[model samples]
Target chain A: MKPSISCKFNRFDLLLSLFVVLAAAALALFFLSHAGGEAGEVSIRDGDNAPYSLTLDAPRRVQLADGHITLVIERGGVYVEYADCPTQDCVRTGKITRTGESIVCLPNRVVVTLEGAGEFDAVTG
Target chain B: MKRTLAALFLTLLLCSCGAPREPESVQFFAMDTLMTITCTEEDLDAVHHAMREIARLDALLSRTREESAVSALNRGETVEDAELAALLTRAAKLCKATGGAFDVTVAPVVSAWGFTADEYRVPTQEEITALLTHVGAGGIGSDGEVTTLAEGVSVDLGGIGKGYASDCAARVFKEENVSGALAALGGNIYAHGTKSDGSPWRVAVRDPFDGSAYVGALSLTDAFAVTSGGYERYFESGGKTYHHIIDPATGYPAESGLASVTVVCGEGLLADALSTALYVMGEAKAIEFYRTFEEPFDMILVTQDGRVVLTEGAAALWDTSVAEHSYQYETINKL
Candidate 1:
């Protein structure tokens, strides 16, 4: 007589199969939640204009305020290369590479913020 | 058995897909800093209202704007704006409470240092002494209807303006019945409620020693947190670095043996003022002030000796596991 399909598999075999499936699901969930890493986008808000974004992978220079303010994005870092604003605080911010770091120009009303998968909602200092 | 396993896998995927939606965020520049407000999508209108409220406060409180009530007051004008008068009274009370460590009348000294004008300089001892004569909270007199400044005394609300703006934003959030929100007006932050997922908002405290890293994070809900540090604004002159926070007593940059001070309170304005006062007070006096203060508050003091000191209250909500650097952590309880 032919053995039934159920008879071929013991309790241990069934349990092993379940364990493998659960492990796969857990790994998938972990990656899904922690998807973004150092590779994120730079969001730039120039004055009252709507904010525009540029991927960190791209190397480029962005000019705002009629070329008075210049922003450079390269090598996974962003910085204010030159700014005509009186304070020049933006230029003094140096290069911001980590997520949630921002370069703010108060006089120019320009805020360049790094947006990535950060663990915190806001940073206080 | 295979069918059952398949069903379980599908169920797990479904659960993951049902995670809470992201909140709507609004970012704007105001009060000389970036302000970001985030709330549930349905409460977006409340965010806009909060922005308008902050703008209104900025107009009334800005010392730079010639037309602002504060500028008028600085010019020795008797301003009749009730809101301004109320804020001045509250500021004076905090100034007196902190034993003049948080005086608003330190504007002249701050200006002499050129922090407000962004033309950084190290004023001479005589110049600072001359400016100190104009610095005192007692010089401000308000009778509920009108407010006036003593001769040569000008008040700068820069220390408390952002914090008050956060308070105004909170008021707007409550008026609109917002379920949850986060308003970050520069260093002053207000975590309105839990996230959409019912988890406390995690706010990272920037490391005083390192700009790219954080010392730790605070899991906060419905709280106001403010941080004061010399690192925020500073300039180097003659081989010495001078920060923006000035000592009321000596009319110089506060040398309180502290790298930074973070104050968490139920009230925004208090948190803002106390952070500055505590920074100026240093470690020992700050702990003493915390214990003797009437209202309940928590503090995180990062000392120059590379120590992160948390009051008992702050320790309850602090998580230093993710801190970028390993520093000595100590918790101080009320005496």
Candidate 2:
């Protein structure tokens, strides 16, 4: 006689378990094939100054004007934590989510934009 | 039995990942351009050492730096830097080969055009003619141990200095057992060896007009690629676009009708010099230059007429499918 452990599971139950496993496998496959690239960079520009590229993986705060404006990076996004600008547009702009997206603070003359997270060896330009 | 077979398959798959991690990278600004050095994470110390070596070379080569070798020689002092002497000797040979098209002594003309100081202006014909008097490789003298410059002539290694520094950094990386390293000093690139995963490294050629996109990719291993273009640095004065690449003959920016030129060679210094030389030579003469040139290199010339020209042998080195389709790809036969 087969063990009671095997008898506890009938054909229908086994089929249901198999269906669940198959669904999870399909979802995993979908994610593997369709997941977008991660946030690779955050480029910042202040006023008429040159743009600065920084790594998005590391979390840090950028203090400018003796902490008048605070730029923070968290969870692969960069957004202003505080700003002394009159309108507070940068602080209200919230987080950046995708490559090519940007948050601009006109009064502070600050710009934070996202760039594609590519696996390039080196950029020629 | 089926589970045992599955476990065996998993073990085989795990053993196949010989180089699972991407090479580590370090970026910094020097030589008035952004430089990036990439290698395995364990070779971080070696990368730092290489960057220091590059900084030393930058100080020694910068013409404006007060105590630099070029500046000292310009001040009529017999400077004693082995690297400077070597560079001068090489520059002399390049100038002779290109018939002064590639001249380090063109610093006077370059400055006269206001490019060196970044205060762009259109110099008068008389001003350029007078500056051209001091703009030839003949004004430089190197005696294998010392370097000197003639009066009014200054050495600007802007063309080849970055390449030399890349080569220097490469040597340091090799000494430190970092075989899979790539150093990009501005528009110059040097691949130290095969990739860490034992595959050829893929490098791209950028479109002169479009900075963000690449025109094509090259499969390089133990090679150097350098490009010189007028698109990146230029100023408009009175409806005229004056670029930084001054033609020693005309005492003006090269009107060779070329947007850019990229040279692939085994030596970084040679590639750097060749890229500028080809751009100055333009299309017709550059084709002639390539046929008779003895050095082994592949050339890619982007023209102002919307043409992309390549040396006859470049087909094997580039990715054909991903090449830019906007411009027709033309190949010149070796004359």
Q: Output per-candidate TM-scores for chain A, rounded to 2 decimals.
A: 0.73, 0.59
- Listed in order, the DockQ scores are 0.45, 0.14
Q: Which residue pairs come into collision in candidate 2?
A: none
Q: What tens digits encode model 1's per-residue C-alpha lDDT throughout B1-335?
A: 78567756765675565556666778887898888887889999889988988998888999999999999999999999888889999999999999989999999999989998898888899998888888888899999879999999999999899998888888888888998998999879999988888899889999999877889999999999999999888888899989999999999999999999999989899899999999999999999999999999999999999999999999999999879897999999998
Compose the digit string of candidate 2's lDDT tens values, residues B15-82: 44432455676766677666778788888899999999999998988876787878888888998888
Q: Give the Å shift of residue B52 in candidate 2.
A: 1.6
Recovered fraction of real interface contacts per model? 0.58, 0.18
Q: Which pairs in model 1 have colliding backbones? A: none
Please state the CAPRI-style docking class of candidate 1.
acceptable
Can you give the TM-score per candidate against the true fold?
0.91, 0.78
Q: Could you tell me the TM-score of candidate 1?
A: 0.91
